[model samples]
Target: MDSNDGFDAATKMETPLKEYFDASTWARIHASLQGSLTKRGAGNEGTRQFLDLVLLKAESGIPWSDLPLSHSKIHNVYVRFCRWTDDGVWPPVLEAMSEAPEAQRLLEQLVRNHMIFRRSRKFRSEILKAS
Candidate 1:
């Protein structure tokens, strides 16, 4: 599949897929991610674009290296994915987006199956600060 397989400007400019997330949901995710991850560099691809690419990757269940250049560099996407996973950045975002019953069920399954982490001191501190 092309890197931009499911996420192109034309597609985004039109209606977004409600099954995944809407534009406002993406905006919240992007803002939260940026605020939480300070070292995130401002890539040419904006947070929305990056998120679109990530969603595409997740939905397609493809290897990170398979991401197309039209999205972002595979290396960058992989690095961000790792960082986000390690930093416990995704659970909250998923929780916030789980408004629909389907989304909530999916989030529940994901957490039930794969959500396990020992909180680092730094991670705890960040959570406290956010509170």
Candidate 2:
């Protein structure tokens, strides 16, 4: 096979969590999370790259240093990750992810397996009321 074939396959390979999120869902989450940022650097493109790095690290459970070198520098990625986390960007992103239809099956499975649990009656009641 041609060496280019390997490159093609690699480009087509989808990460697990990446396959779970559709484009519109990702865009919605990105839009919501982007607004929460207190400072902007690298513009919209930079924000997308940072979000991609965050998702990759979270899904793989890998250290930042292990991320693909094709992405932004580890220091830049790490700093942006910390800044976003501090700015409270993550909670809304997480909530959007949980509410996504593509994730509903996994969420149900987690609930079935008791991997996701309700700790307090009041909180449980609030969740149920919202739904």
Error of 1 at 20 (Å): 4.5
Model 1 worst lDDT run, 10 consecutive residues: 10-19
Please give the CA lDDT of all the candidate structures: 0.56, 0.56
Candidate 2: deviation at residue 18, Å? 5.3
- lDDT per residue (tens digit) for residues 1-131 in model 2: 67665455323332333445677876776766656664664246556555555666655567667766433467777776665554655567666676565454443343332322323655788999999
Q: What is the lDDT of residue 6 in candidate 2?
A: 48
**Which regions in candidate 2 have their CA more than 4 angstroms from the true location?**
1-20, 41-43, 70-72, 99-131
Q: What's the TM for model 2?
A: 0.52
TM-score of 1: 0.52
